[model samples]
Target: MTGRPATTTLWRPTGPEELALVRALDWRAWPPRLPEQPIFYPVLNEDYAIRIAREWNVPHSGVGFVTRFEVRSGFLSRYPVRRAGGRTILELWVPAEELPEFNAHIVGTVQVVHTFR
Candidate 1:
């Protein structure tokens, strides 16, 4: 095996409020999901994330951000990938309670790859 850890790239479309919380965590982890939100979805592709950030998040919050990160493949395998719409619109449905465990498997710091306003 190579020295690098086996990981899968994931992207999240977030609003300013959520991005601020991520920043407060030093970009190391995502904040806990609110009670009403039962799932924490991280999309499989950047295109879907960008679409959400621009279409949904921007309209709701006035600004949005697309963040990318990597997570250990082994840790991610326990959860099934879900297709929300088109073929490319795929995501991992991590239950809110399991989010802490999910965060623990992140391979590196989360990054803001794109922003929309």
Candidate 2:
């Protein structure tokens, strides 16, 4: 083994309001979901995230952002990858209550990789 820490990359498409909450956390963690939101989804591919940010988030909120982050590979294994639509539309569904544990497995600060207005 190369001896580097194992991590899996994930992408999240977010609106300005949600982005604000993430910023409030110093980019170290994602904010808890609202009462009606039962799951926190992070996509497995950047293209899927970008599509959502541009088409969904921007249209609804006037601004959208695609954030990328890494999580410990082992910790992520418990959540099976889910295909939302096409083959590339893959994501991991973390239950709302598990978000704190999920945040703890993040390998680094969340980063904005793309933005749409």
Candidate 3:
């Protein structure tokens, strides 16, 4: 809880807008939220991300993005978590401002797995 929580490397699937924003900001960072978006959600694993991308983002937006990044696992505690699919995957909601700190913890490059087009 003091001086940055323990970190873990994790992957998050992103949406087109988030993809564009992160790209504009560089892989090392995440962008600010829109007026209506109080929280920024990043899923906990590749399987979860892919599901969201395919089932939700792709169906609705026609494209979904997959991104890999590292962040503090403990930091996730401060947010609300929704575990699904027999707890094989989860999602966390982070306030917009906290995204900067989250992005700073990335261990390596944030890669685009592919667009689910």
Index of the highest-TM-score prediction: 1
* CA lDDT for candidate 1: 0.96
Off by over 4 Å in 3: 1-7, 72-81
Model 2, position 16: C-alpha lDDT score: 90
Output candidate 2 Cα RMSD: 1.6
Better of 1 and 3 by TM-score: 1
Q: Model 3 misses residue 117 by how many Å?
A: 1.2
Candidate 3's residue-wise lDDT over 11-77, tens digit each? 6767788778778876667777888988777777788788877888888788888777777666655
What C-alpha lDDT values do all the predictions have?
0.96, 0.96, 0.74
Write down the lDDT that model 3 would get: 0.74
Candidate 1 per-residue lDDT, tens place, 1-117, comes to 569889999999999999999999999899999999999999999999999999999999999999999999999999999999999999999999999999999988999999898
Clashing pairs in 1: none
lDDT of 2: 0.96
lDDT of 2 by residue, 59-86 (tens): 9999999999999999999999999999
Residue pairs of candidate 2 with colliding backbone atoms = none
Query: For each candidate, what TM-score against the reference?
Result: 0.97, 0.96, 0.76
For model 1, what is the error of residue 48's alpha carbon versus the real structure, in angstroms, after optimal superposition? Answer: 0.4
